[model samples]
Target chain A: MTPSTDAPHSCTRSEDELWASLGSPPDAHELQCLTCQEQRRRLAPLAQAAQEWKTGTDPEESLLEGILGRVMHGIRTEIRRGTLFTLTVTPLGPLRISSYLLLEAIRDAVDSIEHVELRTHKIIPHADDAGPISLAVSLAMQAGQDGTEVAEETRRTIAARFAERIGMPIGTINVTVEDVFQ
Target chain B: MSGPEKPDQQQLGNLVARAQSGDPRAFEKILTYHQRGLLRFCTSMLVVPGDAEDVLQEVYLTAWRQLSTLHAPEALGTWLYRIARHRCIDHLRKRTPQPRDLQGPESLAGDIAASDDRSGENPESNAETNAAMTDLRRFVHELPANQRECWVLKEIHDLSYADISAIVSEPIATVRGRISRARTTLAERMRPWK
Candidate 1:
């Protein structure tokens, strides 16, 4: 039977055959196929360039640490203008849900105080929506002076909002006084 | 196949979320978790370590500003990897060729621009080596941009074909084919080395 170009290569033979054709040399098929032969002809310089792009640990650790520390410090300094117990919220995180509800609660918590700032941080995942949800949130606050009196008032207002506004159950709504920048 | 507990990815997702929520400590944790690996990846894709460092910092800043835009939380590693690869491509494009002058044989830094040969058994034989490299780059680069996309995503980031296809917006078969072809092209170029 005359060999046909259209004949499908056998599965058992194809992978090794193709990889071999490329890896080592042009066998009968590759030697004959113009595309494969061309590729075979051109492999040297690139392999050389790729090797030149070597990875080395010659990088300075201080360079990375310095940049990160500098940025973090700058952000912290600016944030302190408001509150201390700052939390960053992950998207779709429990603290995110709770913080939004808390904000709405405070939004309704009697207009005694003027301005407020809240932030959530640190996430711990919860399998069944437990206390933490793989994320930990820190709440940074910039709020008016209110001791136990305001804290309780804030809680009640937030709880009411959570019940009314957020249909889903929320995790923790940690509250902390970041700053009282007068 | 992701099992129920994608524990590693899950943990990373939580850390990112916390950092986005403005938790400094959580952000710190995220850095600690991925920093070394990220650096290594950047170093490999970019020719110079300096460019890698600069790009790595840019990635974090971009991530911080746009953390909320991460649609799927567990894919943070993959997302950062994508950013890293794009930045490398940008770096590659901006590079200007320097006049070739042979630095003495003793200098290890020669490896950076030797262009002489990947394995410089003979530096004078560079023309053949450079031609092969150029051709390899062309053939691999010629792949449908999507195939090239998949191949690079897989090769550079160490992402699986499935992950590569997901990132490149292609079917897994396409990803596999691209990768196979990429390897085939590279292998053909480096047959002597093999």
Candidate 2:
């Protein structure tokens, strides 16, 4: 009897393998098999639809602009609320004052001093209740202005403003005369 | 599947770094880069465009707050998709239970028509194609969430199986299975058109 010469009638690969192969061309077996070819044909529209869905449509410009507005508003709100450490008052409830506002107040006070320019202000929160809040303020004094006098006057003005406006007492104000500009 | 290509890795990394360090402009860049894809992802999962936009709003807000928790800057796309998916699912869960048809094709078609009109597209010219798309949209919306998401991330977005797996929090094998099943169901439904 002649040896059996016919190839196997069915694809050896599982359905999962066939589906995974969808990204690439079908192999020889799949090309020859009517069943796999039919399946591939059915899957073609889906791939085409996917391509069409992506290329044919775009997000509404209004939607994009709206999202940008919302995100920016959110970030601003976050910054306004995020930089402060709440100070708990004994009799009153919690008082929330942002470090940014505090810096602005300090700048206003320093700017009022004659021939003194406010460079920057930083709040150094006390590690413990043993010390009150401290501020480091940098000022550029005019060439003829007395450095010591301007520093002292700016320090007192900021402290008084913090007490008057912020209802918070300051332990110390460190004035750094950064430069003497003409 | 080849979905939308991500922004270049190093560029995205720099954006993420700047955003993490409290640069709002950098963060806005990130949001703008991902917004459209995330919006489409949300719309595919939710019925209302407004609701989808709402979810995206929340997603970006939460991302801003929790950006520091993110370990990988390059993975922002997947992270954003995951957030959008969770928010969309939550939005769905909170809606009062109603018959699915209450939010069906008629409304979606109306949305399509209105959107087309606004965009100056001649819906009359593409009536047949629009009708077919409406039917396909309805069929897709009817699918279970897992299958629908799998299909969206896979075919529609052209994301790889591994990327879909990460976004959906499923094994690669599971992702492939969901996509295959979804394709089969959609193919069966689309046969009439064919």
As for candidate 2, its clashing pairs are B3-B157, B3-B158
- Compose the digit string of candidate 1's lDDT tens values, residues A1-182: 21112232432234323433443645776656665444444544344544432221324454767766766676555444532222234576524343333332334432334433333433333454433322222222344556455445545555555467653344554455443433
The candidate 1 chain A region of ten consecutive residues with least summed lDDT is A2-11
lDDT of 2 by residue, A1-182 (tens): 11111222255444455556777888888888886776666555445455557666644535767777977887777776757744555557656677656765786687578887665467788787434688887766778988889988998899888878887877789988876665
Assign candidate 1 its CAPRI class.
incorrect
Give the CA lDDT, 0 to 100, for residue B55 in model 2: 86
The CAPRI-style docking tier of model 2 reads incorrect
**Superposed Cα deviation of residue B193, candidate 1 (Å):** 2.7
The best candidate by lDDT is 2
Question: Please, what are the lDDT tens digits per residue for candidate 2 over residues B38-77?
Answer: 8788888986657777888888888888888888987888
RMSD (Å) per prediction: 14.6, 11.8
- DockQ for the candidates, in order: 0.12, 0.14
Model 2 chain A poorest 10 in a row by lDDT: A1-10
